[model samples]
Target chain A: MILVADSGSSKCDWVLINNHGEWVDKIKTEGLNPLLLSKKNISNTIDKVQHLLNKKHDSTIDKIYFYGAGCGSSGSGNLIKDLLYTTFNQAKYIRVEEDIIAAVHATTQEPGVICILGTGANCCYFDGRRVIQKTPALGYLLADEGSGNYFGREVIKSYYLKKLPLDLEESFEKEFGADLNLLLQKLHNVDSPNKYLASFATFIFKHRQHPFIENMLHQGIAKFIDSYLLNYKEELLDSPIHFVGSIAYYAQDVIKKSLDERGFIVKSFIKKPVGHLVNNIINKNIL
Target chain B: MILVADSGSSKCDWVLINNHGEWVDKIKTEGLNPLLLSKKNISNTIDKVQHLLNKKHDSTIDKIYFYGAGCGSSGSGNLIKDLLYTTFNQAKYIRVEEDIIAAVHATTQEPGVICILGTGANCCYFDGRRVIQKTPALGYLLADEGSGNYFGREVIKSYYLKKLPLDLEESFEKEFGADLNLLLQKLHNVDSPNKYLASFATFIFKHRQHPFIENMLHQGIAKFIDSYLLNYKEELLDSPIHFVGSIAYYAQDVIKKSLDERGFIVKSFIKKPVGHLVNNIINKNIL
Candidate 1:
């Protein structure tokens, strides 16, 4: 079987394809980021994946492709590969890459722009299987400009500013409480501000119809396009753009509207690129 | 001469009222806050006042009424009073209280809510003489629910989210740049996130007529009132509301419309309560 794993800071989605290019099984395990997770956490996740594999199939995996968070640096990717190689010894070949690469490959291998809109966000202009130009996706603190974290941060600001509708404000306070001192301290002082900010996006998703939120989403997507695509000027103007991430998958209409208004066209929206990546890997016999 | 001084965080506005209860001279000086300004800064501000007095009247001050920022805290206020007392030895009385007190006194202490809407914000229920109840105004990180800081923070979010109009977004980027990494670092890591957030409010002031901004101000004010007053449920049903701040002065119609929609009767809107406080002190002879 050919195994493909897409790991993020929050969770990992896996797909196992048979030798004949037929779908076999799918599995989801806890998040596995080598940078943030401890050895114990990594072991626990591996054990869980093993248990799921045992229940689903009898044969050992022949090859694997891993695309994960914190895999941007070679050191981080090697750390994850070392851990996985030790666990899945039967695997013949193992390759690890940054999640953005997988997203780019899955969306458009031919020169174009690709964007990730999950918990955090990142974008790049892919020039045929290679990232030609990129913008910093400095997580929640620096950027994450067009992602879930951005939406959540805006919602909290609106709540604090009392700019939301009275009923929404009351609801927010009821759900999140009025003690912002504690909330802000927790968000900024805690180790994971990204999670804290991302959690608020659910509140935005819940009230997407609200004018303020709608405007927020529009502005956020516009900013992302402006920052990544518009900066490239003439090179990116005629290129087809595509999105790969949960936020883009769910909010494609909003994204399309924003792009349309800005005189740009969106070619495709794919929820996750793992399936496409797996197919490509098997077709190319690289796994 | 009966010297009357009303100081806020930004600047100090003073009037030298003669025995006839008429203004004989006026002066403006740099802000004097014991917490923010050093003794040297305070002395410099005082020197400016003295220079103004000497340049205009060539007469020494006799009695003084000094109300200012940092005066709400006994320690800070005493420090300020001691400095002013030593400088103007001819003045017999130098009383200091919270700046909001001056706002309340100036607005006719007739049982209503008072708000300060400059760089930061503070709100309190006033009963003629003293503030009966106050929601904690812990700068920007903890609070500052309804002020320029709130407006600026929201605008930044909107710009980052790509929800702002292209022209507006371009202007914002041209003006402030979309380097959210730098912005967030400065906002969160700095000593005063309130000031950092408040700095952005100028963007709103510059584009107050924009629909997005108008909606933001309307929603922001509504949220503030709801948090402070509507949350009281039955007790706030008939209470009159009033505003005293730069924003209240600039956005009176927006504030009034927002409050009216929420079933509130806005009694007054004053730009600065220092004049009213001066009148009150003169009439009551309390100082």
Candidate 2:
């Protein structure tokens, strides 16, 4: 048995596979960023799932591959690796990689720009086997770019600024609230401002028909491309650009329009890259 | 003696105007927005400034006109008034009004649009004597269209998203650290996200020469105009639009461009309305 995991700021997706590459079980746990959690916290979080696997599966666990947002940095990656080692001591092997790498492996087998436009945004120059060149995503605060959080920030800004059209504002007020107090409480006084902000992207998608929102969305997407995707301009013109994230999937039309206008070839835009990632793991015959 | 105050989310500007309408003293203290502070907290905050007046001035405090962000609403205004009355119980007259009214009185003596684009945004149709018609400004979270916090949010979004060009990014990093952790800590874990966010507007003003930043400022100001100024279009065409806020004062070019493009006349723009507010109290020939 093997375990594969991808973790973002909001949640983690986990899959259990048998020796024959057949699905066994899939379980989701709260997001665990090693940088944000203590070693004990990480251990306790994983301990919650220990009983579900049973002794037999736990002992037979062949490998654990975990990819997460903050794990891209060496210090945080090693911290998670150590934490997983303690949690899955029975496993034969353990590997930790950045979520962007998972995105790269999941989306492409040839050289191209691989973009992750989910809760956060990241783009890497994938040369089939690995990321050769990349633009650093400063994180959601400084640069999620075209990610859900990016769009969410815009939505919140527009909503707070009352720039949303009257009809859209009415709908938003009905859905959210008509005041900043609620938003301020949720965003600043609560945990996970990223998730709080990202949640509004759905509202934007729902009201994309509004010229204000459409222009805002276009500007956000255009900004992402200009700041992230456009970094790979030379290679982008030659190879197909691929996106893997919920924001990209739901806003495909907008994304496609952006790409089309920019004259870039989009190979694939997938909502959930886990299936493709799992396929890559099985097809590559990696332990 | 009289004290005229204009308080926003961050700080309070207090000016001592004698019965003769001459300036006597000026004191600034931490912000005292009644909506956010408890009664006890509000009293404690005012207690800090009680001694600043001295025994003579304290005894002679005939009136206090407190104009603050959250004071317009009856409940909050009464709470602050009660708090102040307790603090300066010797005072003969005490009044609490919304900050928007101060902006109106400070800049205009005739019917026109009065805008408060400070940490938040608000506009009112002051029919000389009182607000005959007004647009509801839903605070910073829901509707500070062209305020410092509004522009500040954009600066932060772009800074974190790395949407800032290389040169500006370097400057931003040099001034405010390169990571989002610092920003997140300041904005969430600490207190006052509004102030933390609004603080970035200074950065925007400093780098307004950058094309990216210039465009952002323009967009923000334009949004404010479209949403707030445009609401009173018929009146705006005939009457002068008066702005009172740090954002409007510093980014006067952008604000003027927005107004010019719309064919609206800007009567006056002041960074701090305390001078005008005090002048209004003195020159109005009434309490």
Model 2 accuracy (lDDT, Cα):
0.77
What is the C-alpha lDDT profile of model 2 across B60-106, one tens digit per residue? 78789898987766767888998898888788899898888888888
Query: Cα miss at A145, model 1 (Å)?
Result: 1.2
Listed for every candidate in order, the interface RMSD values in angstroms are 7.7, 5.3
lDDT of 1 by residue, A1-287 (tens): 87788886666889888879877998887657655456677777876786788687988888778888657767667877887788888888888887887787777657887778887787777777468544444445335667877777777767765568898898798888887556644654544456667778888778777787788888888877765556555556778788888778878998888778877778999887778777776666544
Q: How accurate locally is residue A189 in candidate 2, as Cα lDDT from 0 to 100?
A: 36
The B-chain TM-score of model 1 reads: 0.83
Please give the interface root mean square deviation for model 1, in Å: 7.7
